[model samples]
Target: MAKLGAPPMPWQKYVSDVALEIDPDTGLFAHREVGLSVSRQQGKTELTLGAQVHRALAWPRQNIVYAAQTRGMARQRWEDEFWEKISSSDLAKMARIRKSNGNEAILWGRTRSRMGITANTEKAGHGPPLDLGFIDEAFAHEDDRLEQAFSPAMLTRAMAQLWWASAGGTTKSVWLNKKRENGRRLVEALWEALAVDLSAPRPRACYFEWFAPDDMDRADPATWRATLPALGFTVTEEVIAAELEKMDPAEFDRAYLNRTRRPTPPTDPNVPKGKWPGLLDAASKPVASSVALAIDVSQDRNRSAISAASLRPDGRVHLEVVAYRPGTDWVVPAVARLHRLWKPVAVAVASGSPAASLIDDLVTAGIDVPKDKANPERGDLAVMRSGDVTEACGQLADAMNQGTVRHLDQVPLTAAVNGARTRRQGDAWTLDRTNSLVDISPLCAATWARWALVIRGPHVIEDYDIADSFA
Candidate 1:
């Protein structure tokens, strides 16, 4: 893991120790099947990655299979995040990488130990005596066909183990739902019946979860700190609060709180039920090209938003609310972080708006926010004039009205768009951030971000996103 530039965190270490304990009597893995459930942005991915690398290198003639929801994703992750790091280091000499179309693998020459990435199908683990199987993105599974196949393949290995891991999922995740319920039942029974000492190392089945209780208040910072394992590391209160403001209640619960349930419609949603719902597309993602960002604060200064816009290859603009937090303090640091990550054409803020107040703070942090209006460059700030604000708002309305735009099914952004009202900017109109019934900062930020992207051009390198990247 140190060689991969991703040493395990404290929680990872603890979880690995518990879940990977060896049975003293049998001299084999205590846990045959382990389920790990945690919120997103935690180091769960890194934990699984480290486990696979260790198994491949340490065990002679061992075979390992790692899976995501799709084969392309699994292969991409293996090359970009896992193998790339090893190939650059001393580990490359220890292991050989094969990139053939259907025969991709990482093989250690001396031990003949090998690892492979697989597609999500019943045959994922077939044709191999698997020692370690790390099945990821379990939330996306609707059936147990893959598990049934993998478990049978692992039966031949003396030290075999199957790890089915994911965060919370919607009701459609039938397989994961059953596994979670079983794990929960075991945990409770062990606690009540005193089946075995909690500290003892006898694990036929391992269930580790970090989930928020049903009764806790989602908005409470204390609840967040207590529920999320990676809260302090990189996912701060500010980041979680930002996520809360832009995401659907169900999504926020599932992704951040690890509480999966049916997606319920808000009783009296701020966003209208009509046109906006039709535009909800969960698969829409912004390309790295023509990237632009914008910052905004609520009228009361109680919250802030940072949004992104990018030109899709199809020539459509991808507008997204990137972040929304509780206060102004974290906005500058977040902007700086995102700027470094995306390297967008510019970061925009509307003049006379609450976000404009951050100009000085942003400048103090060495992020360039030019006061006077000039031709803005990449790595510089784009301050929108009153006319530009109206133009941006009008452009966004035009796009939405024509159904030329797409958005991820985020409830907050949808509500913001539906609840937004217009204020006269001469003949044109601007989003009324102050007078809107619901907070419209996210929508305003998205509009300005899209405008900036259209006016500027696209430029960004492909991302090698770290699995353990917290903030």
Candidate 2:
């Protein structure tokens, strides 16, 4: 903080105090993992840099790694922020900066310790005995691949510490969401134990979160201070108000108030609120039931997703995305391969849609597809009209609302559901690709699959039908 010309906020001080707690017997940090969830631009980076400086100075030959979502971001933090701070401080005389091959480091000559900054990739945080690992923008990490790679580097250092700090992300943030949930559970447990007795054991991990209540008014000044510790100092209420005017309310809530925007039922009566979550089935698994395949391509045709809908034994519809990839070239082959293996009752595709261009290719591959919807028995393919698309979207929404459909809780699908918007076509409504903030291809695919499953009832699948013919 000294390098940044600032004092630690009260919340930052509290977090630091807990994170630096020592196990007297072992002479190591009590908490090996420390997590911080706060609003953006609240001096988190500064605090982390100060911690890195302290570790570099206190521990001789300590190896510290600072990781971000991208290499450019990591380098900016070190060069633009950390370097400026160190240059302005007395530590400048003791530190040496080096850059090479997309990697940068700061070496403390006196202690023989160094700090490295890079993007979080599969190969990052390796080849060093790490004493400290700082993961910035933790919410952007959708999986644990980078964390898994970095964990082994700390195994040899008994005093190693790992830190994760970020603002709340969307529903698809699997890793960050898990960390927040675990932290909340631990905090709740600790409070309950403290209510009964004073000498209760606390959780070993530090989970620090500062957020406003869900019901709080976002426009109120009190709410700003309650969530943003730097509101009065580094940032002012006037500046935030000006920003609020330019930003979306939901985005402002997530970035400044540290809140997750709950999905509300659209006033246009598209998808009902709370219907998606009610349909989640954790125990849902793939079975031998008759399946229908639906493929959806993004508006830009840069990405496509294929989904399967099947009728479970309990008579409930189950949907899942089987494949998602970049570019449209992989759509035909992938669908054909899945068709040969699964032998789906029908492959649904919308006419005049982005995916419609692949119907000819599918037919050329010796796959039977309906050339026209007028003849129902033309082939295994189901050609959908604009009216069919609207009806399918409505059916899927109604099924979820009535608990007649179940899903495996796929992250991409969940994200699409949360961000999807609706637009009216004549008298019917469909997902609005032009206005949707996130990709809804998964939801679109599921809708077509559901419609196909309804049109084609259950079919008996013989063991021989599962032959691997798509070599």
Candidate 3:
């Protein structure tokens, strides 16, 4: 990084020590995966670039893939830092830079090695046998779909390594939290081991993290330095203070102090207290007009809810929970029965373990659940993503506040609305079931129903008979 005019911070050097560690016996990277969790703007990119450059130069004919959550982020990193550094250095003569859209690559002509930069998608690293994979903004990736896509390519490469680097993410950061927790456990176990167990295999991953205590005073300079390793040099106290003034305190704690915010009910919730009640109309009933059905199972799978929403003649949306059941066993059958009764426009199901587990049941119930949006025969099944959930929650909240939503004032739905807590991801907010005091499945179902009603547009309802078992 210093040779490229961007010097590494002290913390970055410490990260590099572990990330670049090599096993002498195998002549390969000691850790197959390296995870680094630290504050933002702490010279993470500088360290990553330096590592990439080192790999490109040292290993001949190696393929490296650098991916971010979005294409724009990957493109910006390639153009602004990686390309700029290479173009200014003598290394430019040894490589050929390809700037084609969606196929950006840097080929080391001498060694026939190549480095590709692309967005983190299911098919991002499909083509190449990657020697090294770098996942930037790792927290943004909620699942292992992208990793699973790349793992097959790296399986045969004995020296292949995957690196994940990011700051603290929200409660939805399941993958990142797993990595951190696993690393911490390994470290603790090793420290407590009094005798070497030669027969036991060594850990295949390394995790490095720096964070301030949850209760630390944000205004204290001592706490700032304790949390931010680059405070005195690359970043300053004044800059952080200004940022603290501009950002939400919880957000600041996550991005700067690297502290995961305690999941608590928001003081000013996305769905205001009285707004939901105002939107409720006890006399509201399901319209004969085109409607959308949404099914949601609680995280524990102990409860399931089926909700319906449709546009009323008065231009307002009417939403109501059709069924609130005790277990998931009856969900698919109930939905199949509802489909026969309503012949609705679409059935929206959120993507996660619950929905994934229901795919087989849905198939058994004779529902053709399309895998992707491009499927020509969608067959009334709409799989909602995390982004879709966020949008639906926001839309539902907005409609309630605007008095454009009318609910049936069902007890289960009312309880869900009252208990739902906001969980923010970037600028988007979704209901946080993990932090909610009561079941929010009804609210989730209603949100999805509303989303499907508005977003799916008008669809021709096909005649289909409900299976005898479902009936």
Top model number, TM-score = 2
Kindly report which residue pairs in candidate 3 clash with one another: none
Off by over 4 Å in 3: 194-201, 261-264, 267-471
Clashes in model 1: which pairs? 242-324, 242-325, 290-458
Rank candidates by lDDT, best first.
2, 3, 1
lDDT string, candidate 1, 147-177, tens digits: 9878999877888889988999998999999
The prediction achieving the highest lDDT against the true structure is: 2
Runs in model 2 with CA error above 4 Å?
Answer: 261-471
State each model's CA lDDT, in order.
0.79, 0.81, 0.79
> What lDDT does candidate 2 reach at residue 109?
97
Each candidate's number of clashing pairs is 3, 0, 0
TM-score between model 2 and native: 0.58
Off by over 4 Å in 1: 195-203, 265-471
